[model samples]
Every structure is written in C-alpha cells, then in structure tokens.
Target: MSHADPDQLTLVALGEPAADRSTSDHVRGCAACRAELASLREVVALGRESHVELDLPMPSEAVWDRITAEVDRKNTTVVAVPPHRPRRRVRGLLAVAAAAAVIGAASAVVVDRAATSTPVAAEQLLARAQLSRLGTAPGGARGTVRVVRTGDHAVMRVAVDGMPAPQGLYQVWLYDGVDTMIPLGVLTGGEVEVPVPAKVDLTRFKVVDVSAQRLGQQEHGVSVLRGELG
Candidate 1:
C-alpha cells in the first residue's frame, strides 16, 4: 500500500484485492501503487496481443561446449571447489544456476531490443541524451529494450529491474503492427532469448514486448515492458 510488495502488485494487476485489509485499503488509496498496477496491467495486455512464435536454432554442440566452459569460468569466482572432507556440490549447483539465470536474463534483454525494430546496428540515438547513460550497467533488471542486428538475424533484449521473478517462468513476445503476437520463449529467471522465427521478416515487425506469463494460457499475450525498435 504505502510501499508496494511485488506480490501485491501482481494481484492488483490481475484485478484482485489483497488478502490483507490494510494492504487492500492502501492499494485503493495510494496513487503510486495504483499507477504501478496500471503499468503492470498494460504489460499483461501487450503479451496477449502478440502472436509470434519463436523457432530459434540452438547453438551447435561445439558452441554449447564453449558456452558451458565460459559459464564455468564465470562461476568459479562465485563458488569455491572444496577439498576432500567437504564437497561443495550444492554450492556449485547453485552457482551454475545463478550464472545461467544471469546469462539468460542478459540475453533476453538483447532479444527484446532486436524483436522490436527493423534491423539496425545497436546504438543509442536519444534526441538529446548520450548512449553512455543507457548502458551504465551491463545487465540490471532495469534495462530498456534494444534491437541489435547480426548477419541475417536480429536479436531483442529487454532488461527490467525491481519486480520479483514470477511464480513460474517469465516469457517474451513480439508484436507486429496488426495485432499479432508470438511466444518467443520462457524467460530463464530474468532474461528471455528468442530468435526471430525464420518465417517472419525482421523488417516487418516494429515492436518488441516483454511479459511475465502464466502457464496453460499461452495465447493471452500481453506486454510487461516494451520499446519500439528504431
């Protein structure tokens, strides 16, 4: 109410009242909370409108090996390998999962940008702002969607911060001008990576949208955050 709980924010977005009377009362009267709820609702709506489906090619086995190796290198600093008496398997597993989540999250930000606009090299062209401000951090949850082009394909990445992870997995979507939407993929924790489907023309789509999706209702696309591809 006075302060927003991401959980309560979610319930409010779904048009549900909080179970706690005080929280419910606060949400009803708090302008800031209400505005946050509205934004969340809009994102949900955007997800519903997209009808694009991703059929991305997986990285080759050799590529995967390299990726895993890098993952290992990044992970080593986060987790320590223990000596004989006490194995650090649990720590190791958690470290790997965290690294994967970060990678997946960062990759999602990349994909969100690519999906939104016509193919363009990744650059910030704010009317009066410098690009340096846009990327002060490598990948915080609070990143704007960006479109980056590579060879024959475009990638989109949306980085969002503050909101808690969904109960299940978060997903990403692509929306063309005519009310069609596509389910790019499950966001691994904080990021969602979606390759533009081969059948779709990158030049045609103009918006990249991101969302926190619920299971079993795949087609009810709505955007949680969005940016126009330049």
Candidate 2:
C-alpha cells in the first residue's frame, strides 16, 4: 500500500484532522503510518517543552577553529563516492559532518549551566523521525531522533531506550539510505545531542541509523536501529 502523504501526516500531528476519512482509517490499520503519526505526535509534545529562541553571539573564530579540528578527527569515511554524479547537497552534508563534531562538547557543558547562565537560545525543532528496531536489533531496542535549530546553530538530538549494552560503543549516523553515510558521533547515553552544520538540507539525508561498533571501526557496523525522517 502507498504510505500516507508526509505533509498531511504533519498536519494531523499539529492537531489538524486528516483531510480524508481514509487517512484516519489508514493510520488505524497500517503499522508504519501509525508509527509515523506517533512519532510526529511526540514531536509536537517536545515542541511544547523545547527551548525558546534567543539571539546570541557566536564564539570566537579561534573557538570555531578548535571545534572544527576536533570534528575533523572523528572516525569518518566515504563508503561510496560517485565521481560522475551531481550532488547539490555535498556542501550541506559536509557541514553536517562539522555539526556532528560537537556532540561531546555540547552535551557535557550545557547541562548544568543552562539554568543560571544567561539564556542564549532555545531549541526549535526543524525536523524529526522515529527510529524503529530493525531485524538486526534486539526486541527491546528503539529510539527517537530530531534536528533542532538554536539561534544560528543546529544539532541532531538522539534519544534511545531499552537497548542492551554493547561490547564497544553505539554510533549514530545520517545516512542517505544508499551509498553514503556520515558519522554523527558515539552514543554516550540514553540521550545525546550532536552539533549539526548549519548548511545541511535534512531532506537529502532521509535515514537516521544507529549501529554497534568496535572502538577503532571506521566503517558502519551491524545495524541495531534505523528510521526515516519525515
């Protein structure tokens, strides 16, 4: 069966009734459509609790340089490169790489200080999706992921639950669901936020993937969880 239109699903998520009776009927009967609606509903709920936007100064150029260098050292690789293909999104995807670099820095420093520190910006979600358990996943594993813009910067927020411990680490990625993927970062907890390059067009990378990987692994590993962004 054809899937529900994503825009209509978004409308339904925003408290608009489905335009067609069949869409409401279809959501009740189709598992994927149901799941997608549930995910969007969560997005709505999160939006209620999300940060209020604020205008703030970008840190110094030296600060960005160091951050950029840190992001460059991650275990990233290009699994496939099409020499002949035209990619308008190449710049944005690479910026996603730059955004992925700040997961470690942001998650640690921001938690305790947000309350007393002068407010900079609050989270405004740009996009989100539901991560489902793939065949490779254990029965208990599942997750939610979102892209948020705060002031001039953006980050990918990932939260997982019911996953068993892995021997090495769990890593996240923005995948095209085809020949290429960019490592977002290692999953540090049940929830982690990784910086996103301002340039990424979220539509170009439709899939959010999580995999169990060894410490030195540069290649994407056995899939444990995956989902598509709507």
Clashing pairs in 2: 99-195
RMSD of each: 31.9, 33.8
Q: Number of clashing residue pairs in every model?
A: 45, 1
Judging by lDDT against the true structure, name the best candidate.
2
lDDT (CA) per prediction? 0.51, 0.69
What TM-score, to 2 decimals, does candidate 1 have? 0.35
What stretches of model 2 exceed 4 Å from their correct place? 1-117
Error of 1 at 191 (Å): 2.2
In candidate 1 the C-alpha lDDT for residue 200 amounts to 62
Global local distance difference test of model 2: 0.69
Report the C-alpha lDDT of model 1 over 93-152, residue by residue, as the tens digit: 223333454556668878998898687555433211001112222343353555555666
